[model samples]
Target chain A: MKLPRLLTRPIAQPPPHPSAQLVGDLAARLEASARRRLGRGLALRHIGTGGCDGCALELIATRNLVHELESLGLRFVDSPRHADALLVSGPVTRNMREALEQARAAMPEPGFVVALGDCAVDGGVFKGSYAVEGGVEAVMPPDLRLPGCPPSPRQVLEGLLALVEAQA
Target chain B: MTPAEFLRQPPAQGPTHALTEPQWEALAADPELPLLALWGEPGVVRAAFQDGNALRLVALAAPEGQYPALSPARPAAALFERAVHDLWALEPVGTQDGRPWLDHGRWPVLNPLSGRPVRHGGAPPQPEFLPAEGHALHRLPLGPILPGIGEPAYLHLAVAGEAVVRMEARLGYAHKGVLALMPGKSPRAAARFPARLQAEATVAHSLAFALAAEKATGTEPPPRAVVLRAVMAEIERLSVHLHIWAQVLALAGPPALADQAALARETMLAASQIAFGHRLLMDRVLPGGVALDLEERGLSILRDALLLLAEDLPRLARATLRHAGLVEALTGLGVIPPALAQDYTAGGPVARASGVMVDARLGPDASPYDELELEIPLHPEGDAAARLRQRIAETAESRRLLAVMLDSLPDGPIITPLPQRGGEGVALVEGPHGPCMAWLALDDGGLIRAAMARDPAWALWPLAEAAAAGAGLEQLPLLLAGFGLTMSGMDL
Candidate 1:
């Protein structure tokens, strides 16, 4: 289908502050150093059990143009076996507990799990649900947590980079 | 509109029974029965169904909000009375059990609703945990503190190995008094609160709230606003469906499914940026109409993205259906009977998958829906596979509807300014997870008197009890995904 044309032009946006840019650049250098030294080959894998899909969407955006997480040589893998770090989102549901455990078990030794978003960190509001199994801590211990309703992709990238540094 | 006509006025006793004034006169005068299902939210009609026999008055309250304890009956009102006492601080004159149902022991202040300190001079009701007794009963404690996901609630499970004998869930962790907060804000501003209840379905919630306000005030949004609302609602549906579908893939653990999920997510991000200028579309829906309007360019971007989604969704769905292991895992797990669904008044795909064909958009005499051409899909098994199938089918249907609505886009200004004075109204929208109902009651000052949103998770949460029976621990993820219950919506 032919798409409609833009009715109005978007306002020009300002660039990030130099201080913020420097911080981002330093973070990028740290991630690179970690990948070369302590973390020679570690891939990130995203997992979503039964969340609203908000966190998962943000994670996907990390690899896109804006965040460019892939430029740091960070690749998102599909299986836990090849993953050096696991980025799990949502409260683990009762139905998903066993599979989650099995996935965690499949992860290589020394690999870490990062519970992303408010839902994953502590099960946020879904703490006492019958259908839910509880937060990531209930399913598997996490090395780090990035909290927010759905953390921004920039924040997610920063957190992931920080995780790599910790591993180093 | 006559009060009797516009409102699904409850019978003299309840919705099921009509008690004429003289018969119920004394009770009404005495405030013996708390009003039930007083507000209408778009697709769902909540009626306070009386629970228990005489001697106590308990109500299976729906829509949203705690029904005040009715007097005249004592023992029967214990649960209702206790629930109200803990939730909204509506104390019943006489009650049996009072140990706070909601007090988690750490609330900083007296629950503003209760007017007393969190823990004070009042005699605490004897704490009574659910008894676990049955054939080979074993307690399976899920979470007051869990691993991943939002909200804080607990499930006390009485199980024999893998099979659940009985399951009871303790919720209300995210109760921010959304209803109590609603009555004081202007409807236009109040609309923002409900939209964020569940981030993914923000537009659906906002639209539902706005529709209710419009209905109550006897105002129709401009035709363009209607079309915009439809577009926003459909886009919201598409984004959520893609997300839910991705969750199902990730649960199934198939590589192809993961790739498909990534693609779907990309489509959602792109479409969101083009339409509402935000991936989640939060606060874009206003009381009178949509806060943001998509002009020609934005519409084109969405159309292109949707075309790709429509093309790809079917292939992924087929792959999911044909995958042997995935099919085996989902086929008959978590089956909720039609009778149970009706009792709970389940809405959305959970109800539809179980043969309950109540779609607020297409129900009898439903305007707009009556004029719109669409298909109503149903599956009777109510199993995991059936629910997944329903989601896929609905996704396709919603996509088709979106394209049609866009093609015949209405012409006019995007918003219809609301009058300064507001009125009571209710609206319902079929959210991705299920039907989301928002009720708005304006105070005399044109501020929101009460705003309560009922997410589909309320009804589906109970079904988890039934779904857990006889299933091994390994298959729960697919079973839960099949239901597509939203945790945030449930918490609210």
Candidate 2:
């Protein structure tokens, strides 16, 4: 009889992400222009349209418990006016079109967007619904996309980290 | 003839009992059966009510569009009625507050459920939201997009000075027409909708749908399958409660406590994955029984985790209660009067905190919990503190119950094949929040014709109005944190 392992196995090394390379390019260009304008590091404002609510759960966990995104110089802002980037989840719904647009307009220029969850990338299971308007691209183009029903907390952390390191 | 005689079960074997308007009104407002849902189809509308041990199902025919409203008598039916109108275009004749709930009129189709043809190009209907206006009373909107984490819901607060005069919550931003999508799909395939509606309460919703399907088709799952279902439900309850407590702690600051609460939840999630294959136990509970059987090693890990939870949760709860300023902020905050809880039929911690002692598992209904002696936590305060205390008590109870069910684990098949013929069934499973119910009506082809899954959110969301009524604006977050209402569940 074997005693089963209780702990989760460590996450394996990831292949290089094309979005990561693309986001790195954008961040590098944006950082050169905007370093003098902003005081603190990158700020995130998240908008949910219509989703299963999985990514937001993992997002909060990453920021609050394990990853503590603030330590890496990323703070979640209440107002989009203070944000440098927008973290959007769920498929864009027609009802939320105005709200999503206004939030993006309010944010400062270099309006970086990171789409979270498979729904945000491609609308996942909710794609065909009459209310859904497809992914973040329907309203705002995403600089980077994190894919999963919900990508793990570690995955969320990795995506944000990649974007920040790209500015360097 | 007596009303019972006229309400004979429809020959289709679906749980529907077709009734005239007079019969529907009489049965709907009957002091016995409480109306659960009133939804619509092409020409006919269905009303489901839970009457004591047996569920009473009734349907009303609306040839000319309008039908008598149930919300005038039972306040809980308002949202369902509004939903019916929004999707089906079937008007609830005299229901007060005829405002649309789900339809923002932004869709390509006017009434998507009405089978009205969608035009290729059309102007979107512009939704107008007019808040309560008074001198120095301004509307403060919270979220279609909130600060940190959550599903999209807009709570319109009309504030006069420091007090919230009225709070009108506008949901349906997450409405993907989950109920509409279920029809014409196999029961097994449609199972995914309910499972993801509230991601935190996946197993409970899945189990509810499964049990409902079983009841409709008249197939009782094996005892082992029943026990396994209970096991998953209990684990889900534990995870959701822990997550709620973590949110509350984060709100009642000092940050460290919230971090600890999250760590505990992570530990629970890891255990679930080790036992089952998924972290949230998504797609695990099915129509017949369960998706996977737990191996010996998985069982061992689960047992150990439950034991650890039993030991750790109580200690964490005590520390939280004793923490400086927590009691001051939590107690007497967001106090909900007993009347509000009863009127709305608020279940779970919200109702228990208000001292309403109702739990699905403890009832006379037979299932996995028939033999085990269980305690339903009752706190009479109905405040934020009481709700917190109730969640802690329930979490500990879940851990204990999980241990008990695991010990008496049976040795038979984990699934019983579902019947070839389709029928109607209703299931009630105790979610961490409260009793989450699934009422399923499958067609002769064993595919879903109509289905409705009601989360405890239906009962609890209205109480947010009562809870925030007299409280100052400063205390709203504490109230919301303790309440732990799911916008996703409500919107769906």
Q: What's the lDDT for all of these models?
A: 0.61, 0.77
Question: lDDT, candidate 2, residue A107?
Answer: 88
| Model 1 lDDT tens row, A59-155 | 7666543455766657877667877777877777554555567778888866677889887898755555434556799877776778976787767
User: What is the C-alpha lDDT profile of model 2 across B1-492, one tens digit per residue?
Assistant: 455445544435455677778887776565344565667776678776654334567778888768888787778888888888888888887788788888877777767877663543456555546557678887787887865677788888889999988877778888877777788987788888888788877888888888888887888788888888888888888888888898888888557777767877877777878998877888888888888998998899898877766666777888898986888888888888776776676677888899877677764334878777777779999899999999988888888889888888998888877776778787777788877778877788888887888888887778887678778888888888777677666666
DockQ for each candidate? 0.10, 0.55
Candidate 2 DockQ vs. native: 0.55
User: How many residue-pair clashes does candidate 1 contain?
Assistant: 47
Taking every candidate in turn, the Cα RMSD to the unseen true structure, in Å, is 9.5, 4.6
Instruction: Tell me the tens digit of each residue's lDDT in model 1 across B1-492.
Output: 322231234334311332332322333234333232222222122223211111111123222333333323322223334435554554444344555544433233334343242544343233356676767777777654333333335667777877666666665443444444455667876765576566767777787888878766767787777777777777777766666666777778586575565566666666777777777777777877778888788888888987877777787788778889877878788888887776565667788899877676664214444557868789999888888788778888888888888788877777876776656565567777666766666666677655557676766776776687667665665666667655555554
What TM value does model 1 have?
Answer: 0.71
What lDDT would candidate 2 get against the real structure?
Answer: 0.77
The TM-score obtained for chain B by all candidates, in the order given, is 0.81, 0.93
